[model samples]
Target: MDTRRPTIADVAKRAGVSKGLVSFVFNDKPGVAAPTRVRILAAAEELGWQPDPVARSLSTQRAAALGLVVRRDPTVLAADPFFPAFMAGVETALTERRQVLVLSLVPDAAAETATYRSLAAHRRVDGVLLTDLRHDDDRFPLLAELGLPAVCVGRPDVAGAFPVVNLDDAAGLRSAVDHLVGLGHRRIAYVGGDVGMLHGRRRRKSFLEALARHGLDPVGVVDTDFSAAAGARAVVELLAGAVLPTALVFASDPMAVAGLAVLQRQGVQVPRDCSVTGFDGMDLGRHLHPALTTVEADPLAWGRAAATVLLRLLDDGRADDLELPSAALVLRSSTAPPPDPPG
Candidate 1:
């Protein structure tokens, strides 16, 4: 009645390899022949033997995890619809490789920087996924100094020091703006997130440029923190302003949803008085009456792509930048020509 757990020595014996060689295979150390490594792993699998996670990390100097440090207000992060699908996709990819995600929801820049340093210095993760790239990003050199591999989720202004998973943010905003212009909305307004972030800057620039192409200027531009309260506040000001816009283009679905409510509450007839459009194409948009018109860019796909790239980089020490699909406008009942075409 021997019911002992299988050991690495058993795996080595079954594969006709030395104990040290078996250790090398599990640690994913270099200098092991590819075919022999495969055979050793197969033997371990057959015996249902696996090295302890702590022991493996100590030996391999890898945590078998990836880091994602988000710097935002907790309340704002909780309401952001982009994460649900994006995180689902990231987890899907990491799970395949027996890896996990280490998310840090930090409140400020100092905490964000400290978190990255600690994660890198302690070897707590194989690498990190950089999001919310800022104007004149400081993370690039910091990551380089720490020798921590990273994948930027957006293109930074400067040359990338690591792989990039660039999204077509401009395309989405342009589509929203173009739709407004097509609908005879000369006085179109833009509601954007913080201009310091690349996505916010890109969308705002695109909105202005799109209108410039049509010989029109934005009736208004409100920069908020992509919060429901901020969105509601922006809408109130726009509605109360001296010159009301015929259409509103919100940079995020949450903001759009909030604005939609505000407009309806104030007795503003959507499409009859002022049409509305949003970005990110979230489900909440569709649930609202006169479903929100938005740009169809898949955040889930973006997350999946980013995770795939980071995993590849961690494996081989290098990965190439990838450009995801461009966004297109999803027309809905929320958008239409102005009630009275401006002469």
Candidate 2:
């Protein structure tokens, strides 16, 4: 028998066992005795008969790869600071197990469905991690139909048996709005995110709920795509109104930064005249002229949790609906009570 590219027969011959016995030992079947299994393994090592992972998976009807599907432009995802941090956490968990992560970005629902179907049908990945969940997302039903093990990154409005991992957005937003109210802000406006997204909807709901709890009326709500330019234009619109809000709660740090610039251009002093608060407590927020008063959500931790959950689903077939860590309100220089009305 050739030393290189040795086959199972070579291992069996070297171990002084039958080929079937060698197969049983390598496959971890109980038919082979402990001593026989050890001998076969030793012989296989000597012959460098490393089993092909793909072939093994096919024989066992299992795949060791995990899939991650993001519903956004791939290039934009790379530029976003939060996603990179989150991905690092996911990689850490997968690295420990020596598993592969297959990531894909689908711009629309049709593309997402096609990609998912291909992965599931071919068993390319053992499970999937779905991000950017929208209200009544089309992916949810499709995942169920495919019987694919999957976990979502946000809470779905409709309850399903699939796994989910999400941040405590409601509590985080409540704390942020309450903090602003405590600062003596009377007229507060909300610069919302894409209302169709689950996280954005939750944040908006929390904002209104907190305002109601504080016995304050909602001043204005501007729904905009999550972009710095959109946030800047929304702020300008608010400023152009006859009655400008004294405080604003932005859905994201980038938006808050953009709003801050617009306010500065109008010669409005932060905290002294108009207060600002941001979510997603990104590092850039801390470096702002007035440090942003924001909620701190650990994206890395979120990623790690999502990866772990997906892996667990694959390994044990134990689907878990997990809630990841929530953000805490961080009081900074960017927020304060509204200035007294001119007499």
Candidate 3:
């Protein structure tokens, strides 16, 4: 009945095994017999000798903290439903192992690099999660130089020996374009995100490929930042042309909502006059008037997957580059064939 925070020795004594055997079992090391392993586990559980993660890390030369670096406004991240949902998934994965998540927001590449270096120097975090990657991103090379266990959420042009978790952006966009084309849309306008981001680049490339496949050159291609206001402005610019497109593919749900409002204000009948398709299946998209046709990406699942992979890298000293599932096209009332032209 000794109850002073039972140690590995206590577990070994209770199981009638050596301390080394207990260590091997607790550290997930191979070579212990099956029957003996079960007995050791049961003894540890009975004595409440659950391995102290912090102490184990100290002995094993590993850090227990996981750093998540997001290059965006913290306020925007807090308010955005997508990030919150994704965080939920990440938390769920971490909770199972009782690990802490340290999130950081950096405005620029220099600040981001500084933060990573500080974290690494202090050995405060074993691994890091990098989001919002751009073409020729500085973080890619810097992370490689630091030799830190890291996972990038987006694909960066710089190739290195680090794990990456990339979304199937091209497939998602292809599905969106195919849906609109199937709806008899010929002159489709594209409202995309900043060309600097990899996801935006992939979306635009898919859009152009879809247009070529249909033997129809896109009527317009406007790039804007990921904001509702930007989406509205892009739509207006497209409409200013001599021939208005019959349908529009917006790169984000926020932009799609803005575009929808603009069309309504201009007395354009959605589906009847112009069809709209949006990426990111936001909750608001489902509630929009003539509900938005959108590509549904599961942010929660993506976040959980990212966290799980990062955790592995932290705990096992192994890097895993994984490609997550792509978004699915969710058809709704926002899209329809172009209205018949008067003879």
Ranking by lDDT: 1, 2, 3
lDDT of 2: 0.84
Error of 1 at 184 (Å): 1.5
Q: Is candidate 1 or candidate 3 better by TM-score?
A: 1
lDDT, candidate 2, 1-343, per-residue tens: 5445788788889999998787667667676778878899999999888767666667656677888888776665654566777788789888998987888888987898999999999998888887777877788789889988888877778786678898887787888888888878878999988888888888898999999999997688899876787889999988887778999999888889999999998999997899998888788889998899988888888888898998888767786688776788888899988899989
Highest lDDT: which candidate?
1
**Whole-model Cα lDDT per candidate?**
0.87, 0.84, 0.83
Tell me which of candidates 1 and 2 scores higher on TM-score: 1
Question: How many residue pairs in model 3 have overlapping backbones?
Answer: 0
Instruction: Flag the better candidate by TM-score, 2 or 3.
Output: 2
lDDT of 1 by residue, 1-343 (tens): 7699998789999999998899887776799998999899999999999998877767666788998988888888898878777887788899988899999999988998899999988888889988888988998989999988999988888997789998788888888888788877788888888887888888889989988988998888999987778888999989888889889999888888889889989998897889999888887787778888998778888888999999999778789999998877888889988888558
Off by over 4 Å in 1: 1-56, 341-343
A best-first ranking of the candidates according to their TM-score comes to: 1, 2, 3
Window of ten residues with lowest summed lDDT in model 2:
73-82
Model 3 worst lDDT run, 10 consecutive residues: 73-82
- Model 2 alpha-carbon miss at residue 172, Å: 1.2
Residue-level lDDT of model 3, residues 1-343, one tens digit each, is: 6557888888999999998788788888889999999999999999877888877766565666678877776665554556766777778888887877888888877788899998888887877777667887777667777777787776667786667877776777788788878878888899998788788888899889978888888999999877888899999999999779999998888889999989989999998999998988888889878999988887877778888888877656786788887888899999888899769
